[model samples]
Target: MSEQSVTYMDLRFHTPAEQKRKRRPKHTRDTEFSEQEVTYSHLKFHIPSEQQKQQTSTSAESTDYPTPTSSWLVTVILGLLCMALLVTAGVLGAKFLQLSHRVRRQNEELIEKQAILGNFTQLQETLKNCTNQRDDLQAQKANFSKVVSRKGEKCSLCSEGWIEHGGKCYHFSEERRTWKKSQEYCSSHNSRLLVIKNKEELDFINRLVCFHWIGLSRGGAATAMKWEDGTAHSTDLFQVKKETPGESCVALNAEGGAIRKCAEEFRYICEKKPS
Candidate 1:
């Protein structure tokens, strides 16, 4: 009891200076400890931990790389650009083809026009030549008319190779021709086919040539036979001996006058007035 009493008395009866000293030490310790804790918390807040550093670095990597959505979007954009380019190319190609076709067609048209122009030029040249020939023939016809107008002026009645009989000139042809062609030949020479006016003329022509075309034909079965000069044939003169069927022209020979087809080929006699 005495010792506990004495320690308790010492504790309770400590000096005010000593107590102040002790309390000051405790306050200083608390202040220092609190400041250190605040500094540690500040460092923890300012500086990153290992796990936080790893998470931050991973976030940065994710931000730097492209996502699948972004990659797909980029591919789709590229595809769209390619499609647009293709469409543009197709349009331009179509336009180019159309332009080429038009140019080719125009070229063909130009060639056709040139060919037609060439044909037209040739036709014009042919027309000019025909006109010149017609003018020359007209000039020759005028000169012939002047010569034939002077009749009974002591000129020769007939040219060479022509026979004069009964104030008419007669020509015998060696070449064979159809009845129509023979008449055309005689007309071209300013004459007509042989026309027998009487029995004497018929006999004369029969002695000259055989199977020769004369200018005697019937217009129809109801019409009588007539000469090329439109003179009617007198039935009383002589009867025409029929040699074949379908006869339309008259021929004379040593055997007498005969009826023959106009299309048959035969020598001819031409009769004309003395010029």
Candidate 2:
């Protein structure tokens, strides 16, 4: 038992609110001075500066989105520009193709013209050669005529009654005889039935104006008409009448030649080269 002194005991008992307050962090100088940048849509925020954020945030966030009308107008302008480019490209391509086709056609035409010019040049050269040859032949003929005109030379190559032509002698008979007998008569006279060599010879015979037997005959064949000298007969010089089966011999007339019977009687012509 002793005397007990009265003592006050301070006991700490925490409530839920006091416990939560103890868990919160305290703000220090580091937290207050440190700066952080924050982006909120188009607005910028800073940790340290509230007044500056308030001044600039309204302007930054208020930037306008384009209105529908202006958006459509810009889209239409871009589309029109694209369409113009496409149309211009198409026109250029078409023009280029057309020009290419025209150039090709012109080149073909020029080639054809060149070919025609070449043919014309060849023809001109050929005609010049022919003219020169004809001139030379004419000169030779003139010289030969001069030689043939000499006094006794004209009749020197021909018989008494025969005529001279083209280095040969021709005789027109007055007596009518069958074609075979006439040929025999000519053979006995060391001559043969008349053979025409060219237009000049045929013309000479035509001047005689009498139907005379020549060497052209069918020779017992229907289609194979030939001369007695065993040379091919030329149909271009004379229009020969159609031969009957029995008419194998040919006679010369002023117009052309005619087929006659071998046994028919007519005056005859004879031809012989100069001895």
Candidate 3:
């Protein structure tokens, strides 16, 4: 009601101040009394005891909700950091070991290569020495050839059993005999008529031969030259006439009197111990 209407009635004016103070305005008591309640102070906005209790209960429930940092967060984080560092350190240490091993292997390989190179050099030196010795040997061979050819150009003829000795003449009339009988005779005596070898032998024999028969001859044009012993001809121990590899008769050389023959009569030249 308007204060003017309440004074016109005069009853509210006579009411005690204490009693009036105790009474709240109608808008404060019943929510339906006003379309909207305006609150400007704590007393006006104060919530009911029941509603406050309900709010307290709801806040208590949310407080019990778990959060990430509530338990063991520091310890767990510290442990994880330590693990990361340990894993990183372990990886680094393994890599370092691998690298170190590789380096050592490389060093060993280099050392081995150097050793091989040293051995190769030593082998080269040895080979060089061998080559030098070989060259010297070849030179000596050439010199020996020259000396032999000059001494063997001439020979004497008409002697008994002449043997060609070292580029010279030596006669052994004891060894002389006819071609066929000479082979058998020499076999009995354990000594054979000398077989002429090269020009040296021919020259030497000529000096001693007096119609000595040789161990070589062809019995006919188609017959092969051979020794009287019935064995095949051999160039290893005896030599035939210069070009008479195919000659067929035995005779003495005109110059050296060296015994020679054709297939018809092959004087034998036997070989044995030096005695």
Candidate 4:
């Protein structure tokens, strides 16, 4: 062999110890690179811890405060409610005033009606009084007419069954009676026994054809003659004849007057003033 050929063969073929050392270095480098890749994957796919979730929820709650628009909407609703309450109050007040006015007017009307009723009652009383007065006047007028018709004069001065003479009324009785009885009869008729005031009256009585008892009387023979009225007989008048004892009364006829016992019965004449 040549020396150059021997050196070329030694370079191409390595020893066992040199190849083992180069392979050990390459294996260690591959193992280190695989461990680094596993670490990076774990970091990329990780879940959040309990403390991180709490922090996120707190930040979200902080953003939940009321805004300005919502506050304005609430104010508008409160204003609408106040306006409705004011309108209702105004309507109630007006209705109350109207009712009060109506009640006052009714009271006034009632008072007026009461006044009218009182006035009507007064008028009725006045009418009743006038009616009573008219009735009384009518009765008086009727009485006057009857009196005037009987006498045929403007006014009647005497009653019925009486003769008027010298402003006096006279009545003559046909029946006979005692002197006392005749006087009682005259008294019952509102008159007295015929009395002669003068000779003219005696003459006028004598014209009648009646025997009648007179009012002249005496208690005894010596006593003076007197009339029923207690007046003494005048001497100027016609004298009485035929005197009797004890109590005696005078009687007259057409002829003359005579004294007789009081128990003697005769027709009588009565006299009274005109009505």
Candidate 5:
């Protein structure tokens, strides 16, 4: 190998004359230099110092960091957004409570109305029952009045064919019949042979007809007089007249009641109550 020549690089710019002679194109003519450049003739090697590398790394890290003012603005914007979300939630919750209250009130009103309607229905039923009772009472009153009026008319007067006295009627017959036959005929006409309770009735009959069969009679025993209804007769009404010792039948005349034969046929008088 030949002997190597060692050269030192000058840490200085080229001279203007040497630069003009080379006439190299300048790519950074207007740019300012951050560090000084050194040239070595016939060499193409580059190496950075430890101090320079450290400075470049520090600049890059500084560019990534944010400023104090920008960080404060971002924090404030986030806080505002959180506040808006809270307000919206509160409004929605209040609206839900209001809806629930309204629904409960409506339900209460509906229940009250239904109770009132039920009471009204009961009242209507009671009124109908009372009306029915009133009508029934009115009908009973009308029927009672009709019965009273009919009874009064009957007691007031006797029929045209009857003789009236003391709220009673009497029929005098001229046809002759035995006492038993005459009683049978009177019963068929819903009447009875004349019964003289007092002197007034006895005298009234005497005036109408003479020697008619009477209801007075002597019992089967001799001289024991009794009325046709089986009661003993008192001598106060009229003195008894016996044609014989055992005359069981009796007759009435203008004077007094007399005992007569049962087989004898004579006029008769029948007595009856008004219809």
Candidate 6:
């Protein structure tokens, strides 16, 4: 073989160690990475900010906790309102009860007053009826005067103690004691001693002359005869023809009905009550 060719063959069939050395993994060169790949790595590094910031962000767990529970607050407000309403209603009801009681009492009092007034009215009516009855009785008693048909002057009987028999009333007195006293009493009674002229008038006067004292004088010691009345001796009515001054005072007999002395204490016939 030629020498040059033998050397070439030996270089080509080098050892395994040399071949391994030749086949070693090459180091990554700076120029091996592309610009786009570096940029992607940078972006991945920045994306870590999201995780770190999320951890650092002051654990703001805004759990929306209501300051007061809505349900509990509603219950409290409702309870307070109910209590207020109940108190107000109770006060008003008490006032109404008091007013009703007062009204009832006043009504009862008014009814009592009305009843009393009605009783008073009834009493007044009864009193008026009684007065009317009294007037009726008085009128009946006066009926007697109307029945007697004697025509005379209508003087009040209580004041005028006598009636006009001959246009005058002659009042002789039983209350007068003596004869002179009887004369004075007759004068004060607006009458003279009773003088009767005619027989008829004399008999009428004598019928009423229960007892009287007169001025007739007695006969001489036997006490005879004179004018029986204290008047000027008149021949017209009382003087007897044969009579003379015998007695100075006279009184009437209870039985024989004649004139006697004024010293006698016999009952005298009065013409008037007083005057």
Question: What do the candidate models score in CA lDDT, each in turn?
Answer: 0.73, 0.75, 0.52, 0.73, 0.70, 0.50
Ten contiguous residues with the weakest lDDT in model 2: 32-41
| Pairs of colliding residues, candidate 4 | none
In candidate 2, what are the lDDT values of residues 115-180, reduced to their tens digit?
999999998975675456446535644554565566246457776667677778888787999999
lDDT value, candidate 4, whole model: 0.73
TM-score, prediction 1? 0.41
Best by the lDDT measure: 2
lDDT of 2 at 275: 70
- Flag regions of model 4 displaced more than 4 Å: 1-154
Question: What stretches of model 2 exceed 4 Å from their correct place?
Answer: 1-155, 221-223
lDDT of the structure predicted as candidate 5: 0.70
Estimate the TM-score of every prediction.
Answer: 0.41, 0.44, 0.31, 0.43, 0.41, 0.32
Candidate 6 regions with alpha-carbon error over 4 angstroms: 1-159, 172-176, 218-246, 253-259, 269-275
Which pairs clash in the backbone of model 5? none
Q: Which ranges of candidate 5 are over 4 A from the true structure?
A: 1-157
Candidate 4 lDDT, 142-245, residue by residue in tens: 65356447665745566665655566777767689999999999999899998878776776566552457988898887898899888998867776787767
Worst 10 residues of 4 by lDDT: 1-10
lDDT string, candidate 6, 182-264, tens digits: 65666675555555445564544543444466445454556444554533434443434323244545444222234455555
Please, what are the lDDT tens digits per residue for candidate 3 over residues 1-275?
Answer: 11111212222223335555457566566643433334432222333466767777677876986455655787798899999999999999999999999999999999999999999999897567545644653564354335434434543221233333463333333344556676566567565545555666555444434345665556655676655456666565444444444444555533322334432342234433332
Higher-TM-score candidate among 2 and 3? Answer: 2
- How far does residue 124 in candidate 1 sit from its true spot (Å)? 58
**Mind sharing the TM-score for model 5?**
0.41
CA lDDT of 51 in candidate 1?
Answer: 88
Q: Which candidate comes out best when scored by TM-score? A: 2
For candidate 3, what is the TM-score?
0.31
